[model samples]
Target: MRRPPQELWETDVLTFRKMRNLLPKYVFKSLENTIKQRTKLDVSLAPIIATAMKDWAISKGASFYAHIFYPLTNITAEKHDGFLSVESDGSAITEFTGKALVQGEPDASSFANGGIRSTFEARGYTAWDVTSPAYVLETDNGVTLYIPTVFISWTGEALDKKMPLLRSNAAMSKAATRLLKLLGHSEVATVNSSCGAEQEYFLVDEHLAQMRPDILQTGRTLFGRPAAKGQQFDDHYFGAIPERVQILTQDIEERMYRLGILLKTRHNEVAPGQFEIAPFHEEANVASDHQQMIMTILKSTAKKHGFMCLLHEKPFSGINGSGKHVNWSVSNATQGNLLDPGDNPHQNLQFLLFCGAVIRGVHKYGRLLRAVVATAGNDHRLGANEAPPAIISVYLGKQLEDVFNQIKQGEVTSSAPAGVMSWDVPTLPEFPKDPGDRNRTSPFAFTGNRFEFRAVGSNQSVSGPLVALNTILTDSLTWVADKLEADLAKGIELDTAVYAVLRQIMDLHGNVIFGGDGYSEEWQTIAVKERGLLNLTTTADALPILKEQDIQELFETTGVLTASELKSRFHAYAEQYIEVIKMEADLVISMAKTMISPAASRHLSEVSATIMNLKQIGIELEQENAERVASLTNQMMDTVKNLGNALNEHNFTTIEEHMQYCAKTLRPMMDQVRKYADDIEGEVAHDLWPLPKYQEMLFIK
Candidate 1:
C-alpha cells in the first residue's frame, strides 16, 4: 500500500524538530565567549572540549569525526576517522588526543596544487584553526567532531583555502590599524573586515534529480529544454515560501543556529524552486567558515526532506542562476563602522577619506576584482541579465555619487542628502535617507555601510573574493595614509589635506563609479572605450591578471600571499576548470548512452510495431507517426555517435591545453548533442522519456 504523504512528511519534520531542540545552547554560548575573549590557545583545553563535543554528538547517534578543511579547489575537504582506539587489554575506548585535535595528516596527492606537489609526494598536514570553534555533527550511527583546519603540504606550501584567508585577514587588520592611527584614532587597537553572504540556491525533488545524470554528477542540469514558465514574471521574488520548502529551510536554519552560525533571513528568490538565505555579518574569516558549513548543512538537511539542493551557478537554462552576494564592510575595536556615513557625512572628513580610499581601490584593481570571482561555473552567469556582468565597476547610489562629484569640483557643501524610509502607517514612523536608489545590475554596490559584491558564484568559497577585496583595500588605505602623513608634516590642515586627497582620487579614478544600468550594451561600450575598464569574460582571461607585476607587488608588500602561492592558485584554477568540463562531458556521454538512447530506441520500436499491426489490418501507418519515429531515431543515433567521438578525442595533458579544448571544442559539441536529445524527448511519449521533464521537476511540489 502507498503510504500517506502527510503522515510520512510530518514524521520526518517531527524527528528533525526533536533533533533541533536537543542541541546544546552552551555550544554556541561558548563560541560567542571565545570570539569576545580572544583567549590564548591552551593545549590542555582541547581534550576536555573534544570530550564534551564528542559526548554531545554521540548522544545524537554520530559514529565518526571528520577534520573538515577547505582546499584549493574552492570546496570543503574532510578525512573521517573513527573514535575507537584499542588498549593493551583488547578493549576499545572512544579516545581522542590533544595532538590529534591539533593536527591531521592526509594524502594530498589527489588534490590540485598547480605543480606545488608531485603525485608521488602524497603527504599533507591539516592544522586546527583555533579561531573557528569545533562542532559536533550527528548522523544515523553516532556523533562526530568537525574541526575546522588549514591544509599545507609537507614542504610548507599552503595547500588549502584557510591559510590565504587567514593571512588576508591579518593583512587587513594591520593596514586598518595604520589608517586608524593616522586618522587620530589612537584608542583603536585592531580592525577586522566583516562579511554577510546572501546565498541563492535551487531545490528539486530527489527522485527527479536522481533520474538526471547531469544533476547527479555536476550539481546542475547540463541539458534541459527551457520550460514555458521561467522567472519572466518575477513572481517568485519574496513570494510566500511553499510549505515543503519552508520546512526544509526551517530545518537547515535550526541546524546552522545550533552550530553557532547566525542565519537571519530566508525567502523566495527570482527563480522558481530557488531561494536565498542571509546571515548577520561577522569577521571575514568566521563568516567564510560559517558560509562553508551552511552549504553542507543545507544539502544534508534538504536530503532528509527528499529534496536536493543545487548550488551550481546556472542549474537550469533561461532562469536566474545562483550567486553568493558578499556584503563586505570594516569595523574597528573601538569605533562601530568605518563605512557608515554620520548624520552630517558631507562635513565628516574621515568618512569621505575612507570612501575615497575604497573608490580608489576599486578603480586601481578592477581587473583583480573581476579575477576574484572568476570560475568555470561562474562564466555562464556573469555578463548575463540574471547577474552582474564581468565588467568591474562600483555603484554608489545617486546621493553619494553627487557628494563625491561635489568634492571633486571643489565646491563647499553644507549637508549631505538623507535617506528616506516609510512605515506605511501614518502614525508609525517616517525617515529621510540617502538620495539614491539601488542598482541590482551593479556588480559592486554600496548598500548603506557595506559594499555588496554580487558577482560571487554560489558554489565558490567566499574566502578568495574576500581575500582580494581586503588585500586591495589594505593597499589603498596604506597609500592614503602615506599621503595624509606627508601633508600633515608639511603643516596642512587635516580637513584640507583630506579634501585634497579625495579630490585627487575622484578626478583620477572617477570613471569606475557608475550609478546606472551595468547590463546595457551602451554601458559596456563606455566602460571599455571611454572608461578604460577591463572586461575579463572567462577564468582563463582573468586568472592571468593575478600574475601581473603590480598585483604581485601588492600581495607581497601586504604579506597576504606570496608570489609562489599566487602562481599555485592560478594553476589550481586552470586545472579545476578543465576537470569540471571533463566531468560534465563524461556525464553527458553516460546519460546519452544509457538513458537517452535506450528510451528513444524503445519508443521507436513500439511505434514501429504499432504501425506494422495496423498495416496487417489493411490500414497504412499514419504518415506523421512514421515520420516522427524515423526522424527521432535517426537524431538520437547521430547524437550518440557524435558525443562518443568527442569524448574519445580528449587527449590533452596540460591544464591550459585542456581548458582551451573544453572552451573551443568540447562544450559546444555537448550542447549540440543535448539539442537533438531534447527534441527527441519532446517528440516521444511522456512515459517513454528517460529523464524527468522540466515542468514536472520545476513545478511539482
Candidate 2:
C-alpha cells in the first residue's frame, strides 16, 4: 500500500492562520501583535491560548507535549510530558495549564555550562518563545506537540543558543530603529535581522558507513586513501540527482513545508555524493530553529532511505568539503531591505547608511566573526581551496567598491549602471547583466542585497554566526547614529551629513574590503602586511578573540550577552574544540592499531606466502612489496604510539593553553598517523583492507 502524498503547508503546523480560526478575534489579535512586534506576551491570555493549543493538539491525536530547545552544543533537545491527568475519581482527563505552557523546568547540570552553574544547582528553565509557532510532530508511534522555547539557567544566564540569538535580534532592532528614526522616518516598525542558510552535505550508503568505525563515531572518516577518480574531473557538480536521493529530498521538503519552513532550492553540490538545499530568508530566530530542523530531518530521512547524511565539513579529504553559507540582511516593515541599493544607489542615503554599518561592522569585528564560526570540523575546511579562507574580508563587488572609493575620495559620483548582455546570434534573446561578478573566495560577500557568510561549517549551528552578525551590527549602527546626531546638531544638512559620515567610515575602516582571490598566497601576505588583517588559521587562534576587551564591551553594551555569559561561551567552545580533537585522536590510534595494522599484516602475510611459494618453485620474487608494506605498517603503529602519548599530556595551565596544545601537538600527530595509514592503504591488497575506501563509499552511492 502506498502512502498518500502530503499537501504542502497543510500538514501538521499550527500556524498563525490556524490560530486565527481557533481563537477569538480579540485574543488572536493580541497574540498576533505580540508575536509580530516582539512585544511582551499578555500573561492573562496565556490560559486561553493554552486551552486552544491543547484542544488543537488533542484533535490531532497528540497524547504528549514536548518543549524543544537548542543547547550549547549544535543540537536540539526536548523534554516530554504526557497530557493525561488523573481526576479525583481516578478517571483520566487531559490538562495543559497556562503556567505549564509558559515555562518548563529541566536539569542543567549535565549540559556544557562552562561553570555558570554548580552541579548541586541543577535547576534550568525553558520559556515559551511565542514568536515561533508550535507544531504537532507525527512519528510512527504517535503524534506530539512540540513547542519552541529558550533554555536558561536559574539565574537567567543563557544556557542555549536561542537566548543569545533572541537577545542579539532585539539589540539589533533597537539600534536599527533608532537610526531609522534619526533619519526622519516618523513611522518605523520594529527592525529584524533575517537569515537564509544554504546547507551542503554528503550522502553515503549506510552499509558502507557502518563498515567504517570513524564515520560511525566521529561523523567523518579519520583516515582514508584518496579515491582513484575523485572530483578532479568536476563532472559531479550540478549533475543529475540519484533517484533514491531525489525521493529523500521530496520527503524532506514535504516535512519542511509542513513546519512552515520555506525551502526554495535543491541541487547537486561541487563534489560527488554531495548536495545542497537552500531556503528563503526568514526572521533570524525562526530561521535558526528551521535550520536545526532541516539538519535533523536530513539525517533521519536519509537513515530511513538506507543512507547516512554526512554534515562534517571535510567528510572526505581530497574532495570539495561542505559549507553552510548564511545569507544575512536587516530590514523592517517601514523599510524593505536596508542593504538593497535602489536603482540610484548614490541618492539612497538610507541604503548607504545601513550598508556602511555592515562594512564598518565587518571591519571592526572581523575577529569576532571568525571566532563565531571556528570549530574542529571547520579547521579542516577553511583555506582548503573549497571554502573561504580564515581571513575575514568583505567583498562589495566592483560597482559598490567604486562607489565606496569615491566616498573615500571626498566626492559624490554617479552610480555604476548594470549593463545588458548580447550575443552575435540573433536567435537568442539579450538579458540584463549584473554590475559586477561574484567572488566565492570572499568570506563575507555582498550578493546584490545581502551578505553571504561562507565560512560557517556545514555541521555547525547557524545561531552563533547570526548572533555575532547581529551584535556587531548593533554596535556599528549605534556608532553611525551617534555620528549622525552630532553632525545634525552642528546644523549640517541631512544628505551632506550622511555622505560625510560614510566618508569618515570609509577612510577609517575601508581596508577590510577586498575584491581579489582570497585563496591566493599573494593575497594572504598582502592581507596581513598591508591590510593589517589577522589570519587566524585555526580554532585555537580564533576562539581567543572572544576574550578581547572590545568584544566583551560590545556584547555588554548591546545587552546581547553579559560578561559572565560571554566568558562561559568562550570556555564552552574551547572545551568543545579540545574534546573533538581528543576524540578524533583516540579514534586515529584505535583504527591504526586495531584496523589498519591488522589489515596490513594480513596482506603482508599473503605476499610473504606468495614469495615463499615462488622461491620453492625456484622462481625469484622481489621483496620490495613486502618490505614497503611492513615499513609503512610499523611507521603507522609508531605514530599511533606517539599520538597516544600526546593525548595523555594534560599539563595545560588554562583551557586556552589546552586548546592550543590540542591544535598544535595532538592534531599534527594524528595527521602523521593518518599519513602512514593512508599510504599503507594505497599499498595493501584491496580485498584485505578492513575499512571501506573513499571510492566505494562516494562513487557507489
Best by lDDT: 2
Worst 10 residues of 2 by lDDT: 1-10
Tell me the whole-model lDDT of each prediction, alpha carbons only: 0.81, 0.92
lDDT of 2 by residue, 490-605 (tens): 99999999999999999889999999999999999999999899999999999999999999999999999999999999998898999999999999988888899999999999
RMSD of 1: 5.6
Query: How much is 502 displaced in model 1, in angstroms?
Result: 1.5
Q: Point to the candidate with the largest TM-score.
A: 2
Which residue ranges in model 1 land beyond 4 Å of their true spot?
Answer: 1-65, 81-97, 412-416, 419-429, 432-434, 601-654
lDDT of prediction 1: 0.81
